[model samples]
Target: MNFWYVPWFILPYLLLAFILVKQHKKSNRSNLFFKFIYWSFFYLFIYLGITEIQDKSYFFTIPVLFFVLFSWMYHREKARVLNGFLLNLFIASFGIYLLYNFLITQDVLVFALIFLVGVFVVLVGLFGFVGLMILFYWNALVVIKRESHSLANLLTLILAVVMTIWLIYDSFIAKMLPDWASILLSILPMMFFYFVFAFLNFLSASLLYQFNQPSYDQDFIIVLGAGLVQGTKVSPLLANRIHKAIDFYYQQRKYTRHWVKFIMSGGQGPDEKTAEAIAMKDYALQQGIPEDDILIETNSTTTLENMQYSKEIIDRADIKAPKVIFSSNNYHIFRAGIFARMAQLKAEGIGAKTAFYYLPNAFLREFIAIIAMKRKLHFTIISLLASVLLLLSIIAHFVS
Candidate 1:
């Protein structure tokens, strides 16, 4: 037998192990997509390496590796428990198939294994589609629930729930039928779901455009800062934010929400001459925001700190509970909420319009932020669960 396959199995794992060790020691972890890709490659290499070393069959190792990974995921404390469960199902189902093929004389076991695998695959697909729907609709519900009065809220919530249930029912029924029919039915629904989700984001932004400007009772409107170009001139990204703030200021004046103080929150970059807050103030005045109502908060750099520090300035004049709005790009609304909640501020997160090309990039950044904040509990649970499941499967393999 050619031994050339040995190094091929060993090299990727060696690199993967290196990266994993490096990442574990770092204060910040890498993106989930990268982590998954690296780990997948690592696991694949390990399975192949083990097969080569033990002179065992590839089929057994492949299924066994999947079982271990899935079991680890299942028992682990990650939010992806459903994923782990499905993977475990695949491994367990595959294991049973192998066992029946080797130990039983009947073809019925093979048929049963096939049936199990089919069901498992269908369920996994359903879970993925539904999970996406849940995430999207939940975000949509949050917007609707917040903006809508009680009557509207009730109707919207019911509609959302009904739509979700309908999707699940439709998927289950279609999958229960013949294979070709199932595939055909699944395609349109899944595409429609994604289409709706994509358009809902736009709809959400449109709703944001209707934010009432400050009239007579308005006190202050705050514009959150994005990173500047070279820490000096406002990046086009940040310009969008400033532009919205200017619009809000003018709109409020138009609607009789007059003399709203504009507070810009951001610290100066090391390379920039002035703080972001100061720069924003200058930019707004350049665009005709009166210098008197414009206050600059230049001390803090973070979103939370931006809010906190700005509130200090706002409170100096005995205006603590101002009907404040913090503006950021649309993708950042949820995270800005988290920071606002943390700072104990009474503020509504208003999203400014962002460029379409920039949104995908912005969303990726937000997703990474969410993962980093809750990684330990997530990773630890996932690892432990996967390990336990793998152990149980191993014991079961030996005993059976």
Candidate 2:
């Protein structure tokens, strides 16, 4: 409405929208700043609207809700591949918080809600984060007992041990240590905080990637492979992926009348009788998928290779601007998308269902992988934090 608001709130939001739409049109789905920029503008514009309220009509909610509406509309428009689901979670919680404060002003009934919440908090505090930690350790034990002893499966176990050790040290041992020694050891949790941030980002990105789907008219469904059963048959895990690809292939063909190819991608392991891709293709065929529609890339042993080798096959197909999607288990889809981008493949992933009990450990493993993917950035921030902490300690010594 005013000239000042136009520049401060309107212009920047419109500019962000334009950049996102432009990047979206070009299929540049890798910009990690989109969510941050969008949400920043979202809260800013809302706060601005609240400040400038002049008994405006309901339509004034347009500017107040502009960024929220924009997020809802554009989120499914292939722009959500950038991740940050935690931002969405934050939006909901913030909205509820604001709504609660507003309604508390209206009636005494709201006080009952607050009182109930306080009571619930008190009850739950009896078995709070410590209880949560106990569950985490138990889950880790279950993962180790039921799954392989591989490093991936051992993630929960390792994390549990680290957390328990830190809890004991921070709770009991820190009091007896020398002041400087205690101060330095305090950096352990500070360092852990950085990794915790990375884990949250990874978790958010994984949820966002899985929720944002590809169009039904994709040209190919590249099924990323896993290991086989006893070196011959498609393991249930691998079969879940193939089943997902087939389901998508069938649904797309049925609804859109667009026949998509399946690129079964994987290689034989040291103990396998044949390539994982071959076994995947065999399973797909048994499910009544046409053999002509299934293509196999049998040389990929890792997810990275799956993307790279599959891209090579896709390039050889000689189609101009072909649309493609890959199929894998839900937890694996996010990382597979990263690998696809790394391989320069313009594709989205269609995630298959993962079991409930399996998700926590699988997500932890994926979180670790994502953290490893950006070791340099983490190391730099960590080093900077260490220097800051040491400087603060030195200053505190002199000040004291």
Candidate 3:
């Protein structure tokens, strides 16, 4: 059936346009791009729901409601988290579509769409997480190459935009041209874009890992607690960091005759009877670390507070001024450093290994935290640049 036959689509678009006009007249919000995406999705959902109502096709509405549900539930002030929720919702919608297709008719078109969606979803999801590693490597590359990160980021943005547009165009051409070759058209472009960024990130991370191996020993080593499991026992995630610190302690013992103290730093969470720091200390003792060498800092719940309050405890103990090593997980090291640097603690940021599949959820969480910081200026800059680039690209396309 032709999509134009659905009057619901037409009505929703008209209503969406009116809403945009009203918002534009009433508010100082100049985010036309964001408004466009928001209204587009809003209307598309209404269109789908209305069509499903008229046709009595209840299955199609399930995915639409699911998307709305998850998006609202995960809604935060962070762009990355917002992006992630939307991305995941799209994947969920596509999966639902596949189920609908299988139930209705087992056709090649639906099968192809499913495969194409899978490719794009994998591409986008993998790169979104790996982008952090890219940023890290990009930092090192810029330092050595004496290049500006802003320029590099701009170029990357341009390339991603171009590749996505090309992929869309190529998919249309592939669908139009032939029967057997259409799937190849959809899959190849997405896979290519995904692998291109994936390999770049992998190489960059390798370089970062190689360069970032210069380790140091300090009088005080702070294991920043990853909040407790059920706010009681040390989480396996937090335990990994503690174990790393223990290994470092044993290594120090083997190399030098100096005594080092471990500081388990975190505060009481709402659900916990005791502070996270105390739990970490107990875990350390259970793991065979001597009790005397373990210091518990129970006043910090955040990373910044972890460093700040831990520093005070060390200062009061008259243990040398602020040279410390901090252990968290691998993906967390960069942001942890930002906090450590903010606290002006002389610190080494070390990360324990984490499982691959769980990285997306964790990284999405971190991205949300980062975006909540000084966000207005960052959003303004991003919006301005996106607008300019979009206008330029459109103008170039029209002229050509």
Candidate 4:
């Protein structure tokens, strides 16, 4: 056996990759399926090449290299903010990580084949499962005690306690239970896998969203609103958003002759002394942003409304094809971009820095919110999967 004429097929693969990338750039979100197809073929090509090359490193390096390549492409293409490209990137990265662990630990190969639960254990590493669980519990408690009593923030505490109970039951108590009882309880693991898959993807996408840096050619810096401190003052959290916009404003002017206008988007809450947008404007004014340059939209009660109302203002401002950026806290940007897309606003979001400890808790809430957006579709899939598992369990139960 010898190597020859590999170029005949290899050239077409390269050509297909080019066409897919070009189509994705042209159609953006609507072209997401092309990305999925591209990655599927990409992995297949890698596996097939390994047979010819007889090199195991191709399995590891090729996936990681493609992940980096697409990740760089994702960061550069600000046009498609909420598309499947990011999800594909995460899939490539996760698969590469699992493969790396298998190649290294050898004995770990079996576990890595079983999906994230096994990889989760792999991550536990020298710390061990018990040690990792204890660390999770400690962080959960810290979040619950320090954060507000909102249900969103309390999810960490609830998850920590629930996982602890489930593990205890599965590890020890399940051995003594009747076969059918245990069979029925297997549904929990099924659901656990489903949710863990979702949560991990969300975490990956949220983490990747931060790498987006919009160009200085923007015409509008739309600052999304947050809750006011004591209903009357701009909190540090809100100021961070304003400052991100202001920094971009100055940077745009410094780099080019173009000037950008700020759109302060927020409405009055019941406890607020004034509209949040007005309060944000006051803060920007104090920071030396000209009152004339800032446009206030004080009617948005939610993030979607913020995008919709701001789009209206931009449309009426008589700007042709206005390039815009929306600024919010880092965790909030991904979800807000979803809203921006829904509102048919052609703009990319730019997130500002927020506190570290607050990120995980905030991210949990954002993940839930994004899930809720496609609730009917997601609920149907979850129900279908759960039903399949439950049906299997029932068959075992009846046979027993």
* Candidate lDDT (C-alpha), each: 0.60, 0.73, 0.63, 0.75
RMSD after CA superposition, every candidate: 21.7, 8.8, 21.8, 8.3
lDDT, candidate 1, residue 158? Answer: 51
Q: Rank the candidates by TM-score, best first.
A: 2, 4, 3, 1
Candidate 1 vs candidate 2: which has greater TM-score?
2
- Which prediction has the highest TM-score against the true structure? 2
Q: Indicate the TM-score of model 4.
A: 0.75
* Candidate with best lDDT: 4
Runs of candidate 3 exceeding 4 Å displacement: 1-170, 173-216, 320-322, 371-374, 389-400
TM-score winner between candidates 2 and 3: 2
Worst 10 residues of 3 by lDDT: 205-214
Off by over 4 Å in 1: 1-217
- TM-scores of the candidates are 0.47, 0.76, 0.49, 0.75
For candidate 1, write residues 240-300 as lDDT tens digits.
8888767766666665645678788988777787788877887887887678888888888
Q: Which of candidates 2 and 3 reaches a greater lDDT?
A: 2
Weakest 10 consecutive residues of candidate 4 by summed lDDT: 103-112
